[model samples]
Target: MFKKVPILIFFFLIFFVSFEDLYSKDEYFLTLRNEKVNLRQGPSFDYPVKILYKKKFLPVLIQDSSDNFRKIRDHENNSGWVHISQLSKKKAAIVIEEELILFGKSTIFSNPVALLKQGRLVKINKCKIEWCKVKTGKYKGWVSKNGLWGLL
Candidate 1:
């Protein structure tokens, strides 16, 4: 029985570590799953609707969770509870800077593709060390990661 003690402790440690990882807040970012989602005052549908979000793919920061709902904060600093089904793991970001220049290449010296104003939302294709490839409407280019929100 003494030999089995070490094995039991190893399994317990693994299970505890996995549980911590599953519940860590760690700046979880998610996007709107549908074009229309209601931000409620509480975690349940019985609560009053605080806001009606109309933009799909809008990035939100997950702050807390209760049952099937998650408390999220938008780029505008608006906070409310939303159903988990209305959120998606798909990566997206909002331009936080006043005027962010989208470059043809990741390097700043590259030709400018477009100028993105603050509050502009774009889908993230991929990210490098200091830049991210993004797409918004007809514009597709690389922007510095510093100018974006919703990234860890």
Candidate 2:
């Protein structure tokens, strides 16, 4: 019986490592599931004025639970809840290069931003909108919607 002690310990260790994967936060890659999503100010359709999150867009901030609402923070640090049905899970390319630009500051408007690195993730903010916003290095800002991705 003593000879089996080490084997049992090895199996126990393996189980412990894999256990974390079960409880880890569920992550989903955004996909353009809907034709359009409105970025409302409140959780329900009754909310007040706020910018619109148009169609076929990918947002940097992702949500998986259909809680009917999502708490979000704007670049100005404003916080509020919005309707989850008004959003989609579409993924896009984000520039990860060390050097990048703030879309508003650039003039080209077409290909104003460049020097993007590989493997960076960007949620197309709004394709129809004039400016597109992206999330990189934990920071969110606007980019031209026509360039590559749309506003989510």
Candidate 3:
């Protein structure tokens, strides 16, 4: 049993470290997995439902976590808790500024591909510096990162 003691201790340490990394309060963004998700006032099912979000792919900031629940804040600054299963790691963002120009290239001098209105949800391809490559419906282009909500 003496030799088994160290092995068990090593496994425990690994599990603890993995758990912490998985749920760390690093302020990352996650999108809604389902078309409808309930935002609770607290971290459990016993808590009241504060909001019923019907929009899928809506990005929310993961502020904190409790058990299987995540504390999130939406673009409107509404904060609440949601179950982890309702969240997705898929990169997405909502246009926060009205009439955002989607440029063919990352620069403003590039040709305007399309105009995106506020509340438009776009799948984030990638982001560099002050611009992000996004796709919304049939259009895909770069937009100013300042006009979006969901990036660090």
For candidate 2, the TM-score is 0.35
Report the Cα lDDT for residue 129, model 3.
97
lDDT of 1 by residue, 12-69 (tens): 9999999888777656899999999999999999999999999999999999888999
Clashes of each: 0, 13, 0
For each candidate, what is the lDDT?
0.96, 0.50, 0.96
In angstroms, the error of model 3 at 148 is 0.6
Backbone-clash count (model 1): 0
Q: After superposition, how far is residue 43 of candidate 2 from its true place, in Å?
A: 1.3
Q: Which candidate's TM-score is highest?
A: 1
For model 3, the local distance difference test gives: 0.96
Q: What TM value does model 3 have? A: 0.83
Off by over 4 Å in 3: 1-25
- Which of candidates 1 and 2 reaches a greater TM-score? 1
Model 3, position 116: C-alpha lDDT score: 99
